[model samples]
Target chain A: MTSLPKHPPAKRLGLAIDLDTCVGCHACATNCKEWNTGGISAPLTDVNAYQAEQRGVWFNRVYTYEVGGEGPDARTVHFPKNCLHCEQPACVTVCPTGASYKRSEDGIVLVDHDKCIGCKLCSWACPYGNREYDEHVGVMKKCTLCVDKIYNQNLPEVDRVPACVAACPAKARHFGDFADPNSTVSKLTRDRGGYDLAPETGYLPTSKYLPPRPGKRSEAMPAAAPAPAIAGAGRFLKWVDRVLTR
Target chain B: MHPAYSVIFFTTASGAGYGLLVLAAIFAISGLMPATAWLGFVTNGLALGLIAGGLLSSTFHLGHPERAWRALTQWRSSWLSREGVLAVATFVPAGLFAIGWVFLGTTTGFFGWMGAAAAVLAVATVISTSMIYASLITIRQWNNGIVPVAYLVLGLMSGAVLLEAVTRLFGVHGSHVDVVAIVLIVVGWLVKLAYWHSADTGLVKTTLATATGLGRFGSVRLLEQPHTEENFLMQEMGFVVARKHARRLRAIAQATLFVVPLAATIASLFVAPMVAMVLALVAVVSLAVGLLTERWLFFAEAKHDCMVYYGR
Candidate 1:
């Protein structure tokens, strides 16, 4: 029952993250927690929220990496990571029960909570460290790609995207069908040379990341306008003025 | 990779069970041992008890122990499912063989074939158990020919040692069984050493750069972690052991599992029957401790591929 499909899905729905513009604010991660706690995979457990080591299950997480050497090439890249919804996800195939499976229609991998025994083999099988165990619920939890919100009829058409996609202030995350060449995510990947997170592992993930643009310096500090030169008494007055103003 | 005690005990104890079953059946079938009722009862009881205890202990590690039966449903794709199915199937023939030989006193003719069938099933179950770890591509140390080979060989070797002890207890001493145990022990040690060599020599094909797909930019380092506190992934896969400590454990394993047992087994042939039985029993205890330590290291030393993202 955990065997993979013989052929890839006709419409591979996924996300394309633009690393060039991610500001590392963690809005997506926060937004994911906000939405999913009340959404399809509800009440993401927190073992001890008020105590030390307050760990909670999150579908989205952000990491910062120093990609290049020091000096001009040095830059901190903000990486937002989640399930890639792989075409050949080991997590699905490694499940001992039929609980873990992939949808043939849209290629989203999911766990059937009723059937899950929570053996944790799927967590070991994933090289990306996406799936995590919910100790309180005694089952595995993962990113459902906001499947409920995306297809819901209660919400407005424009607000139907994933919470992470909706909350990204920099417009770094794009959600669309990747199978169609004309789709927005497909075009973004094609145009920006988006690549998989761990291509060497060869899971053939549907999600792609647009690598940070080289040496553009979007975060460069703007030069401050020169302050008027002040005499000894005037400088003292200016200092007092700034201090008293605050 | 955290070396959970439940799993450690399960693999080692169950392996010994299956191994003992294989050799006991073989000895009965080949007419090497007499079809004594007490011998059959004691040996089969010990084997079945170990297998059942080990299997039961494994369930405590699962989050939903009541739903553990559902694990057997996905045998077509899951090695764990196949192991569960095979482990249960092995019990049928092994139970039959035990019943026929111990109760009916039929060790030759039709029951001998049943004994043989039980032996084959035991071997298949052990192999299936080995494949549960060996098939995982994420753990490079386990995804090799050596893992399965080591499991099969060690299972047989441990079983052979137990078989020798049981035979000695029943006043049945034979140099042939000792010789077989010696060869299996030596082969097990050699395979283990070879496995260690392979793992030590850059078995990892993925690196931090390759795993992150940022090698073209230059050397990548983790400036900050995704979480300030430890998460599930870190707890499960972030187990690390110092090389110095690991080396010491390896030496301990070699001496107790192979060297001590080998020497005791060899000395048993020259010693008096009373002393020989004591030596054989010593070998069993030492080998059990040794296998436990080895299994612990097996989990402790494995580096999950996902750790690359954390700059491991």
Candidate 2:
């Protein structure tokens, strides 16, 4: 089962992240943890929760980088990263057990905890470092794309998107069926020039990231006229006149 | 990249085990080694013991050791799965050969064919093991042509030295074995040198800019990490070794693994049987230390592609 699906999936459900608007607030990350901890892959396992060396498994992480040089074009980019649900995910194929797999129907990669041996080879195979190891459960965990919530009939249709996408305050994360040409994610990718992370790895990630757009300088305002030269007494009188007029 | 001890031990020990099995089969089939029950028992016992022990040790690092049996189910796509399956299947022929040789005191006919089968399986298992590392394109240092070659040669070399020590201790001497050991020592070290040279000179294809798809904006640099504390990715893949220490360790590995073993093996060819036995034993010990050091370095020096995210 670790072998890839013989045929490509018809639907590629994925997210398109806008780096331009992400505030690096980590709200999506925390919301993802909050939802997923009690969702399909429960108990994210925070070790030493209150200690100085606190560490645990998390599916999404945000990183800040200074791109370009110290000039007008320079910008600070907040990059939020997670599993891209690659079409040809090496993490699935490298698994010795048939635990890691991609759904042929939707192209969503998932891990079956019961079948995992916890060898961690899948983690090594991932270039994006998206897979997280749960020390307590002794199994690999990752972004499920809120599969449980997305499919639940009890939840409102508006709440069916991924927890991260729904929780993004700035609407930086957009989730939809990328396989459809008219889908929001697909159009966003086309319009914003969204790109795959680590494309050189050849994973063909389904998710895309919209690059940060450069800031625009306003050119509509006119330059102010210089004040007329005046003698000391006249300048004082002018200042008094200006103050009184104000 | 964290250099887990269990994995290092498993690779080195099982590699040597398979190598010994191959050599033992060749010796028996070609009439190089005497067909004695005691010798057969000792040789096969040692080979199987090392193999089984190493394989068991490999599970020590697994998070769910109780679920280790599931690892054998995915051979169709996974090299690690293939390795596990091949390793276990090898035991069948190897066990039969051992029984035929030790109990029946024969190294010919059906038993000889069985030995041949075992040898082929052993070599295949080692190759599978090597492929587990080589197939990983994420690590530039491991995804190379020379990794499997170096692993095979070093395994064989270590086996040859161990065989020499055991045979000499039993008062059985073969000049051809000594020559083979010396040749393998030189050849194995040469392959290892090539591997190290490539690792040293190879440029990392993935960088922060490429990793984040931000190269078009010019050079990208990490202004702030994702978290203030180290996460699982950082702890598991962020391990870094200072260049100075790596160089020193490489020299030590060269001296102990190649220089000393090669010298001792050659000198054993000319000395008295007792002195030769001692020298062979010394060679075995030195090779063991050197192999461990080299294996440690193998993990320590490897930089995972994920490390680019951590600014490693």
Chain A TM-score of each candidate structure, as shown? 0.89, 0.88
TM-score list, all predictions: 0.95, 0.95
Give RMSD to native, each candidate: 2.8, 4.4
Per-residue C-alpha lDDT of model 2 across residues B50-101, encoded as one tens digit per residue: 8998899999989899999899999999999999999999999999999989
Q: List clash counts for every candidate, in order.
A: 0, 0
Docking quality (DockQ) for each candidate? 0.76, 0.76
Q: List the residue pairs that clash in candidate 1.
A: none
lDDT of 1 at B254: 93
Where in model 2 is the C-alpha error above 4 Å?
A215-246, B242-244
Candidate 1 ranges beyond 4 A from true positions: A216-246, B241-244
Task: State the TM-score for model 1.
Answer: 0.95
